[model samples]
Target: MQRSTPRLTRILACAAVPVMLVLAGCSSDSGSDAGKGSGSSSSASQDQQGGQKPATVAPAKYTKLPNPCKSVSTKTIEKLVPATKSKAGTSGKSSDITSRGSCSWNGLDDNGVKGSQYRWFDVSFLRYDSETSLGVSGQKRAENNYAKEISKAQATDGAKNVKTSPAKGVGEAGTAIRYELKKTGEDFSYATIVTRTDNVVITLTYNGTGYAGAKSPDSADLMESAVAAAKEAVASVGVANS
Candidate 1:
């Protein structure tokens, strides 16, 4: 009976060793899994803390605009608007000269019995800035405004025989619009050119009216003068920036 008891004790001890080893192995596996979960959680938290970046906008081409009254040459103005009241050109009211500006000239060429010829000319400029939130470039904004100006000229009230066509060698892009209107018992001819260069938009308008018994000015002549003046104005933008 004594011998049997000793053998039983040894067997029992041997069984306990395997059971303890199994428990230790399970504990080690649990610790390793916990460490792996902690690492994954930290990485995910870091990713959440960093927000998405904003989109980058392109740089503007031109930063400044030319002086409105001096954008066109004096000789050009004189030829376009004969007998001008102000050779220096009358500047339009502008809150921000850098962003927007304008100049105008008007005159009356009286011809005794032949009636009178009235001429008017005006030019305006608008500059745009690059925006990040909108993700739009200044040149793109100018392009949009250029289209709007052409549409406005074409939609002139009481206009007859309206025509619009492209003008070459004027700027990056240009459009010439011509129309006739009867106002105050006289026929008035209008020619407008809208062009864009870089980040600036240039709009030039040349108009003439015949008073008394004078014949209305020819549309072709007015358009030619407008295109010439527009080319000068477009060139001025580059000069000013340079």
Candidate 2:
């Protein structure tokens, strides 16, 4: 009888195993339902947040820049630098001309009867492309760089009495940075104009000095020339792209 009683208890325990397993399954099902509800809410929240991403960016105004050497006109070149070594101007070395380009003209106008005048002009253009991933427009990029260029000119090495002012009618946005720099025992009047027209940023630097007792170039004259050249350079970008 004792042995039979022990076997009965063992049988009963085996029979209860299935009931315990059934109860566990039911608990799991309840948890799964709750999890599904929470997961759906989370997915909905994610979808709502995702709606704000992937901002639209406008197309760049100018995809390509003008020929650096040809950006300045022949007449302007003649007036700016009287005896330039190259009438076409010297093209600065640039690996990628599509986005950036520069040209420089240097000359020493030797007038034996009236001393000599040295003139230099450097002009550069930088084109910015809209970054869709970064959610930045090309115009905004150019605007940021325009400010940077002005700040950079104001911090030029050896510059003295640096002045900054608006360059009216030069471009959509423009700034003139003028300073005097002494080099090689000569005082050079420097005028730099930083301007932005849409996605393009134009920087024009014009400087001059006199030799053999001639008067140094006037700052006003240099600034005026810089503005004119900058306006032309800014226009060249549109013409090239158009």
Candidate 3:
């Protein structure tokens, strides 16, 4: 009976060894899976911290601007402003011609005793760049400025009978403002066109006043000329960018 009891204990101990080994194996596998999951999480966190995502912004359409002085053709200038002092157009002072530029033409056409006709024409251009921090696209910035230009022209102090209308087919969008102002003892008819093409804005102003006995210029005619010149100016932007 003592020998039989010893044999039973040995068998029981042998059975416990396999059960303990199975439990240990399961624990090891569970620990390995946990370690793998932690490593994957750490790798994902590192990727996020290392600039894995980048900010995006809309690209600018027009990177450059055309020369303001030569934007309008000679024939157009000659027809608009007779006997222009500077046939090449007088360029305005601009620290950076690439981003902003302006040109002006003014002259008086004398007709002896019939008095003289005075004419003035000017155009300006502004270009914008895309800014990510501002979260504004180049085209959007130009659109805002285009409205501001129209407002500026309409808000001219001492201007009388100011009228604003949309100018179609000139560019992506445009506005024309016509007003009459008495300056230098003469009534001047003014026409201003503000337009935007992609990332650039163009403002063209045409104003004239009859001197002495000459008749004042017609607003419709002045606006027509201004629109034509504005179309030319807007087209120049495409050419410059191309």
Candidate 4:
């Protein structure tokens, strides 16, 4: 039984601002909390053993990702984000919704497994401004909304128990609230969520595992670290000012 955070709401009227207009703030962490594992870390060394160039860094065609987890690292993100294969060769993959002050990572399927790989770490970042009372109120509402989501997800069939904690000293933004959802009912999987909010930025993340295999997923801690890294990456980009 995980304790819930207070609800967050927004009050300000969302102004139409360019995504790059605001001076965005970002943060990161590369500590033991990242939970790096053998399979989830920099396997470049291993790639060479198997006779590969460690794969080229793919060209980053920067699309205006509304829900980009700017605070994490590409390396870390690459580990947590659901890969194309994670969907079992499905077409209509999960949908992402993003706005000036809000971002959401939705459409997660419990059965989105790939062979023995039935687990994935989904990640998302929601950026919003607490401009007006309405916006501010609405932004605050998210805290409660997320808390409730974790509560519900924990109580779900596969979720065994849930734990919510304050992600303190992990970034340079607002208070960060993290949720760890463990799997129950013979399913060995878990998920984590990290939310950061201040006057200028309100971001959230959904990182977990639903991959298949008789064993549970590895690298829960590393997944959490990646979320922190993503925050740092976004801060490097700065906010868009309009």
Candidate 5:
């Protein structure tokens, strides 16, 4: 009877060991499944927390544009164009185009070729005061109106790859508009329009410069330089009477 009891006890112990191991393995599997499910839920919650679409990153060059109007001067402008054309204002205004010291390269119309060398420049000065209040922010309203008009003109004129950027207003002056136009035949143009108001005097300048890329390589810089110089010339035109 003793020998039978010992053999029976050993058999029972061996069977109970496998049952415990099986239970442990089942528990571990259940825990692992729960952990995986929690991980999935957490990921979904995180995704929901970010409610909007991903933001697009623009190029640094486009985002950070250099002030192309830096260090502009009338003397430097005159150097670019040795010839100056004089025109008098017929409206009995003291602010004639040339009298205002707007110097330019003459006969630009007759220079180079029609589409190759038609680089031209012009500057205008308009005065505004309390009597000419168009908007609360100096000439902001006028500048805005002019920008809109230019946009419309560009659209109607079938200009391609058009980019318009404006700078912040300085003092009581409004803002400046810098634009780039690329034509179908690789023709390019650069322009700027600005309104500066100092004390009661307001000066506005508009310059359109074009270069024949076919005649030279990448004339955008030349056009930019010319327009900036023109702006300087226009700004030099103060109140006619003052």
Candidate 6:
């Protein structure tokens, strides 16, 4: 009986070994499949993210703008504003000169008994950059703002006898606006020239009034001066970028 018991015990142990081996094999297969599934999910996430890309737009023609104070020639400034207070011009406040800039000259020429002539000239520049995220080209932006400038000039408060006409040979496109206004109990005449050259827009304003007995400046003369100054300002943009 004792010899038969030993043989039975050894047989049971051998049978248990096979069951343990089967359990280990099942565990190994499950682990491998789970790893493969995780790998596939990660690869798919990366592929989806990589598919999204930013849209492209046309590049801007002008990257930088010329200095507003130096954009015009001394001869032009002297002719426009005689006895000017500052020949170098007074620069307007600008946080970003590359994007926007302005310069102005003003003078009151006292003629003693003949009264005084007050003249003022202002020139401003605006440059646009291509926006890839918004998908807007610089030239398109300039064109849109050019229209807005015209509207703004026409809507001046207290302006009378306002007129608009094409400004020939100034830029790619140009407009001349003339108007009259009453201020400080005096009659004033004004002329504004708005021109767009590529991605940059130039606006020139010339205004004058007679103090005492002097005659108010003519609208036609102001428009001519504004147009000529605008042409020079537009040319400076090309020189700056070059």
Candidate 3, residues 1-242: lDDT per residue as tens digits?
A: 98799767766665667777645543442797868888999998998898445567798888888989889999999999997999999999989887899999999999989999999999999999888887788988998888888899999999999999999889999999999999999999999999999989999999998888799999999999999999999999999888
Worst window of 10 by summed lDDT in candidate 1: 21-30
The numbered model that scores best in lDDT is 6
Give me candidate 1's TM-score against the actual structure.
0.80
TM-score: model 6 vs. ground truth: 0.78
Model 2, residue 166: distance off in Å is 0.3
Question: lDDT values of the candidates?
Answer: 0.88, 0.90, 0.91, 0.40, 0.41, 0.92
Better lDDT candidate (4, 6): 6
Considering TM-score, where higher is better, how would the candidates rank from best to worst?
A: 2, 1, 3, 6, 4, 5
For all predicted structures, in order, the TM-scores are 0.80, 0.83, 0.80, 0.40, 0.39, 0.78
lDDT-sorted candidate list, best first? 6, 3, 2, 1, 5, 4
Q: Tens digit of lDDT per residue, candidate 6, span 117-209?
A: 999999999999988789899998999999999899999999999999999999999999999999999999999999999889899999999
- Report how far residue 97 has shifted in candidate 6, in Å: 0.6
Off by over 4 Å in 6: 1-55
Off by over 4 Å in 1: 1-52
- Look at candidate 2 and tell me the lDDT of residue 94: 89
Model 2, TM vs. native: 0.83
Candidate 5 local lDDT, 150-215, one digit each (tens) = 445345354545454443333244344444454544444544444443322222222334455334
The number of the candidate with the highest TM-score is 2
lDDT of 4 by residue, 85-179 (tens): 32222122334433332322223334545433333434444433333433344345445544554455445553444554555553333333333
RMSD of model 5 against the true structure: 18.5
Give the range where candidate 4 is weakest over 10 consecutive residues by summed lDDT. Answer: 5-14
Worst 10 residues of 6 by lDDT: 21-30
